[model samples]
Target: MNKVKVLTVVLFIIAFIEVIAEYFRIIPLIYVFKPLISIVLMLLYWLSSTKKETLFFLTITTSLITNVLFIPNDLKFIFVGLIIFVFHRLINIYYILKVMKTKDFIPVVLASVPFLIVFFYIFFDTDLLTKEVYYIMIIHNSLISLLGGIALSHYIMNDSSRSSWLLICVLSFVTLHFIIFIEKFYIELQIFRPIAMSLNAFAYYAFYRFILIIERSNSN
Candidate 1:
C-alpha cells in the first residue's frame, strides 16, 4: 500500500528468488537479482525516513557502495569494498557511542575479546588472503566487534525492545559474514550460500527496522 510496505514485499520476494536461484544452481538472472537487494534496501530506508541526520544518510550510502562493489566477485573489488565497509562500521560505532554512555565498557570488552582473538588466530594462520586484505580484515573485524559489542552492551543496559532489535541487526551481519567467510576461504559449501543470501536480505530488513527505531527515539 505505502512505499515502505511495497518495498518490504519486494525485498523479500527478491530475496526468495535469490535463495531459490542459488540453491537450484539457476544461473539465469541470478546476477541481476543479486545486486538488486542492496538497491531496494537503500531505497526502502531512504524513502521511509531520515534526512536530518547526516551521519545516518552517509552510513546508508557507504553501505550501498560496499555492497555494490563486493558484488563483482573480483578480488580487487572485494578488497576495496571491505575497506569501505570498515568506514561503515566506524560510522556505526561512532553513532552508537554518542547514544550509549553506560558503564558497560568492561562488559563490552569482555564479550568482544574472545571472538576477536579467535577471529585473528584462525584467519591469520591461513594464507588465504593477501597481506593487504588480511590487514584490512583485522581492522574491519575489530570495528565489527566494537559495533556488535556496543549494541550488546546497550541492550543489556536498557533491556528494551529497541535495543534487542539493534542486537538482532548486528547479529544478522555477523552470522552472514561468517558464512561468507567460510564459503569463500575454507570450503565451498552449496546450501549455506543460498541460506546466506536469504539471511543477508533479512539482515538488511533488521537493520532498517533498527534504524527506524532509532529514528522514532530521536523524534520523541
Candidate 2:
C-alpha cells in the first residue's frame, strides 16, 4: 500500500485506541494517545497532499496544540488551549474569505448577530465559568458562529460542485463545538464523554476530507 493508505490505517487505529482507553477509564493511556490523534492526522494530510496550503496547515497545527494542552485536565490550561483554537478559527476565516467569491457582507453580519447575542446572553447568565473565562467563551463562540455563517454564505453564493462538501465541513465543525460545550458545561455523564470525544475527532477528519475534496474540485 501507499504511504497515504498506511497513514490512514495508523490514524484509525490511534482513534480506536483513544476511544477504548477513554471508555475504560484508563487515564494514563488516554492521556498518552488522545493528543496524538491530531498530530497523526496532520502528518497524514501533510504526506498525502501535494499542495500544502498555509492556512490549512496552521489550522491543523493549532488543533494539535489545543488537543495536547487539553490533555492536562486543568481548567486554566484548557482555557489557554481554547485561546489557541480561537486563533485557529481566525485563520480558517482568512482562508474562507480568500476562496469565497461573494462580496455581500450584510448577510454574513446579520447571520452572526443572533448567535452572538444568544451566546453572550447564555454566558452572562451562567455561573459555570469565571468572568474572564466567560468572556473567552463568548469570543470563541462568536468567532465560531461567524466562521459558520461565512462558510454558509460561500456555499449559498457559489455554483460550484464543491459547495455541498464545504457546507458539510462547516457544519461538522459547528457540531463538534456544540458537543464540546455540552461535555464541558451541560453534562456530567462520564460514560458518554468518550463517545463525544470520538465524535469530535471524527468531525476533524471529516473536515480534512471535505477540504481536500474542495481543493480537488477547484483544480479540476
Candidate 3:
C-alpha cells in the first residue's frame, strides 16, 4: 500500500508538471496528458487492489480535464458544476433506494435545473451539439456518477448500515471545500492539487474503515 501511495505521488508530480508546462507555454503537451496520467495512476491502484480509490481519482481527474479543455465561461462552469452535482444526486438516489429509504426529490430537481438550462443553451447557441447530443452528455455524466458513486460506496463500505454514510458526507465535504479553495485563491496549483488529491484518497480510506467498523459492530 505504501508503494502504491508513493507511485500515486509520483504520477501526480508528472501530471502537475505537464499541466503547468502547458499553462505557461513552456511545452505543448496535449491537454489529454491530465487524463492520461490519471488513467495511469488509476491502473496502478487497480493493480494494487484499490479499485475504489482508482475510481475516485479517475472521476475527479476527468472532471477537471473536461473543465480545463472545454474553456467554458463562468456560467458554463456553474452549468457543469450543476451537472456534477446531479451526478452526485443520482448516486445518492441509488443508495437511498438500495437501503429502502425515501429520497428527497427537492435535491434531485434542484440539481437538474441548471444542467437542463445548459442543455438548451448548447443546442440554441452553439453548433457543437445537437439537442440529442446535449442530452447525451447529461445522461452520460449522470450514469458515470451513478455507477462510480455506487461502486465506490459499496466497495469502500463493508456493512449494510448507515454509519458509513457519515464518512461519505465528510469526505464529500472535504473535496468540495478543496475545490472551492483552489478556485477562490491564486495559490500554486501544483502544490495544492496533490494535497487535495491526497485528502480525497484518505477520505475514501476512512470511509472504508468506517464500513469495516460497522460490519464488525453488526456481526457482534
Full-model lDDT for every candidate = 0.76, 0.74, 0.46
Write the residue-wise lDDT of candidate 1 on 1-220 in tens digits: 3988988999899889988887876766566776777778777877887643666667767877776676557898998898888888888777666654445588888778766776667677778887888788778668777767777777777788678877887888777767777787888867987888777778667767777777777778
Global fold similarity of model 1 (TM-score) = 0.85
If scored against the real structure, what TM-score would every candidate get?
Answer: 0.85, 0.84, 0.37
lDDT of the structure predicted as candidate 1:
0.76
Best by lDDT: 1
TM-score of 3: 0.37
Candidate number with the higher TM-score (2 or 3): 2
Error of 3 at 115 (Å): 24
Q: What's the lDDT for residue 218 in model 2?
A: 69
Candidate 2 Cα misplacement greater than 4 A, ranges? 117-121, 159-161
| Best first by lDDT, ranked | 1, 2, 3
Name every residue pair that clashes in candidate 2. Answer: none
Worst 10 residues of 1 by lDDT: 95-104
Candidate 2 vs candidate 3: which has greater lDDT?
2
